[model samples]
Target: MWNIMKYVCAEGIVYRGLCGHRYADKRRSVRLWVGGPFTHQIHAVHNSVPFSQTHVVTSPPWRVLFFGTDSFAEESLKHLFASSCCRQKAGSAVVKLLEVVTLPKDLPVRRFALQNQLRVHDWPNVNVQDRFDVGVVVSFGCLLREDLICQFPYGILNIHPSLLPRWRGPAPVFHTVLHGDSVSGVTVMQIRPKRFDVGPILNQCIYPVPENATAEELGETLATMGAKLLIDTLQNLPECVANRREQPSNGVTSAPKISTSMSWIVWEEHTCDQIDRLFRAIGSRIPLRTLWMGEPIKLLDFVGKFHTSLSGAEAETPGTVRYDRESDSLLVSCKDGRVAFRAVMLKKRLSALDFYNGYLHPFFLKKLPRQQKKCVFGSYKTKESDTPLGREAAHKVQNV
Candidate 1:
């Protein structure tokens, strides 16, 4: 049995339309679906909105309202535009892209959308008209109001980075890397008003995290996967929405956004596996910051392997910086292990040993008159919260 969809007007009015013949608007034509893959234009209620131009026959593809302000959104939009639903059998555009609602500060997404001749809107509360059939949002920062979304017959769809109820929030991709999750996936689901990511799921696809894939690498993979998943779901929007399944709220987890304060690595606190995973999360930006010789040191690159005899440092001694001149590599101490590193951000992507000896050691080491035994490299702190980032600290949301 086909499911009946309802729509509410701007004036808090509720109305329902039958499956066959209806008038969309007096000024335009309404295309109503009689059965599978068949449609006809007829005069119906003035409230009904036309999906396509009335003069031409056949059901026009959905008029999609895109909400995204990042690369992820760009990928999905590209797929939709290149897909058959967006294009007609004759090579003409079947679906129309309404204005894109994006973040004010996101220039790249806006630029891409405008380049395709699509209108872009940046205000938080986008003034949504009733003409759109469906709204598609991916990586959009703001929350859409329920009143605005109610105007459409087909509800809004959101493409999320992680599986629902597992990593739900703004930073699923980041958390997936930080936590060393072997499995990562994309979720295409309906958006619940005000809530972050709790909604009924329409489709999902999972993939393994590569051996040492950074957050950016994993995100790139998911971006492509999610784009395809979203387009496929949209192609069968009616059935998918009718068969939608709610996300299990029992295992709900929040992947709060990342912050600078969460980048401090506590050398003694985290184990070798944890430290290596964090380096992967760093990807190509926001290298971990920690104190060395009472001065700040930035960790640019880290290797997955642990070094014991290579560093000549005893096991369990964390925060010891060692330089292997032969290999041109650097080792930083971690709990029960030493993690190999390549560079520090202050200098070029060269050996950290060079950075320490040439500049950091000369200026920073002299300040410490006495070389204390069992000294932790990251012990210096300007404030108490500067402490190393732990599992709890990593996920902790500050001032949201």
Candidate 2:
């Protein structure tokens, strides 16, 4: 009887009685579930068919319009194009990359599409004459309007860097690393209008953020993970069609676009940990600028710590740089703690020692002044008239 009911359900009668009214109420979703709110059970049951019946694709390949303009999105497209499921076979709803909606011609994504012989249409100049099954957007650089999103059978799908409802906007990768999060991941979700990333998540994949991993490294790692996850989710698209749940209400956070202001390391204002994170998050994205020997220098790498040597004492002038012969690193002062500038760039990239020897040492004395309660930044006070370093020392004194 169970086998008979399963066949009856497969024939579609069981759901008509149980879900017909609900399906009518939600016109957006074509397939209504058998178990109502518990969507995955029956669908996953069918999707678990024997490998011998692999040819049996329950639905035809969805007509997918890809919208993206970056390497991250390109990675997802590569998987989508190369997957065996995307081959020209007789499976129902197997994905077909009908066309791409990308930025102008010179961009990497557009060039990739053209090289692959895929049709490229500018976003606002969307070719809507032919209907589309679904739209997949990944870092497309702009939001789609409601009418544009509504044209597809299903609305847009976004491949986001961080898990949705957390890190819910652009530059999620930066914020995740900035906050020193232990774990971060990618989310493929419905792209809603007015707000970005506020949609039902189709799937998610998580990976750990190892200590000291830069934002660029983490983003690339997540992009690869996201691509594989998106492919698997698409392969099981039929099961996932009606299975999405709304984003959880709690634990929401925004990852706004990275700004130039975020690139500055405010040693006097920020703790060592915070300044270290700032450099790590935006180091690759933008140059971290700071005063080295009172001359503006771009920071390449930094190391932060509680400064156990200054256990009972405190950092006197936060931006003051000190020489640590033990590590061959340039230690700088931060509020409550200390940090090291491992690498920096002025006209060219160089290690802290190289910068110190060529520029900083030439300007200031070899030894920083000895102190008792707090680390003192005293050097290059030639006379009553102040040089650049002297002026900086004077400013530090006033701040203290």
Candidate 3:
């Protein structure tokens, strides 16, 4: 999904194409969550709208409008129009707002076309005079035909969240979360016909995703970031029009549109680091795996990057339980060495100290000789006649 990048406290014209993502080559195989993956485009447009009281008429800041489906995008535009923030303080100065007209039902191939890209014949409310000074398209799911591009005095600019040419698809943020990339950014570019995310760059910004972000969270966060970038560029449109800088050709990577199959978690072929990245990038949309007893558990969160050599135990394998249930930390074995879990997810909820205490089985207790009390979490007070097992799991850890 595209997020609009903007400059606060600046004047400019910005157009919004609240379009959804439609597959260029394989429509039958693609699927996505509505208002996600590609829905951030709408969010970028909605949030970046100037909340000032400027009179937006002829020769005003810059004229902007939206075109989209009758469903989500159209309704979203209506909500924006109704917002008090968009209205000027003086009732006399109305911003040049336009009602979203639905796509035409009369045109051939109307059903297959993106709601915004249907032939004008397909637009029931097509007015030949519906022209604009500039266009900013965030999550338009349809391909913009040449006629639409020619309608604007300035070309249409799009907000793509990935650093263009890589992850150039409908779900860059989703893929970034799933893949666990350390950095993901937003891009603003010219909307070239038929080419997806290959336009000349206007501007781009990248941000870091920590090891715990889920897909839903990353998508919303990126949308907010991207929208700001778009608005900032719009404020400086005069400079951009005077001097259009061509995008560099070197680091291009395409994020192809994703599907439900792409969302499935692969337990094998995934390193702990790889798995960690995917979970953070995808966010909560993709669940993490854990087993309680014999049933699989959906983990809300867990700690990774464990060190086996730190355990000081030659006999313990990676993921092996140095389970200290009393302290709420589990020493699980990793591929290379042993790592400890101070916290874990049992269902959707995260367990602090008591969670680990509840899972303590007697067999898990027999594995350690009771000397591994590193104070993971909880009360530091020790009983006078403490056994080896009690000592190991009784130390206190600061809850972070």
List TM-scores for all candidates, in order: 0.77, 0.72, 0.53
Instruction: Give per-residue CA lDDT, model 1, range 1-400, as digits (tens).
Output: 1222333234333333322223244333333342222332333345445453222212336677888888878898777676534355653443555568787774667988778777777767577656677788889888888776655556688999898889888999989999988898999887778787887788889888888788999999999999989877876776776567778758787899787666666776778788777878864667777665444567766665554465356554577776667656566777767777678754345466776576445465566556543235564333536545333332332311
Lowest lDDT 10-residue stretch of candidate 2? 1-10
lDDT of model number 3: 0.48
Deviation from native of the Cα of residue 233 in model 3, angstroms? 2.4
Q: Give the per-residue lDDT digits (tens) of candidate 2, residues 128-164.
A: 5335656788888797877677555455788899877
Mark the 10 consecutive residues where model 3 has the least summed lDDT: 24-33
lDDT of 3 by residue, 300-351 (tens): 4456655434546555433345554444555554444433445555544545
Off by over 4 Å in 2: 1-60, 84-93, 292-295, 303-315, 346-400
Off by over 4 Å in 1: 1-60, 84-88, 91-94, 307-312, 345-350, 359-368, 372-376, 380-400
Q: Pick the candidate with the highest lDDT.
A: 1
**C-alpha positional error of residue 149 in candidate 2 after TM-score superposition, expressed in Å:** 1.6
Model 3 TM-score, 2 decimals:
0.53
Model 3 collision count? 55
Q: Where does candidate 1 have its weakest 10-residue lDDT segment?
A: 1-10
What C-alpha lDDT does candidate 2 achieve relative to the native structure? 0.65
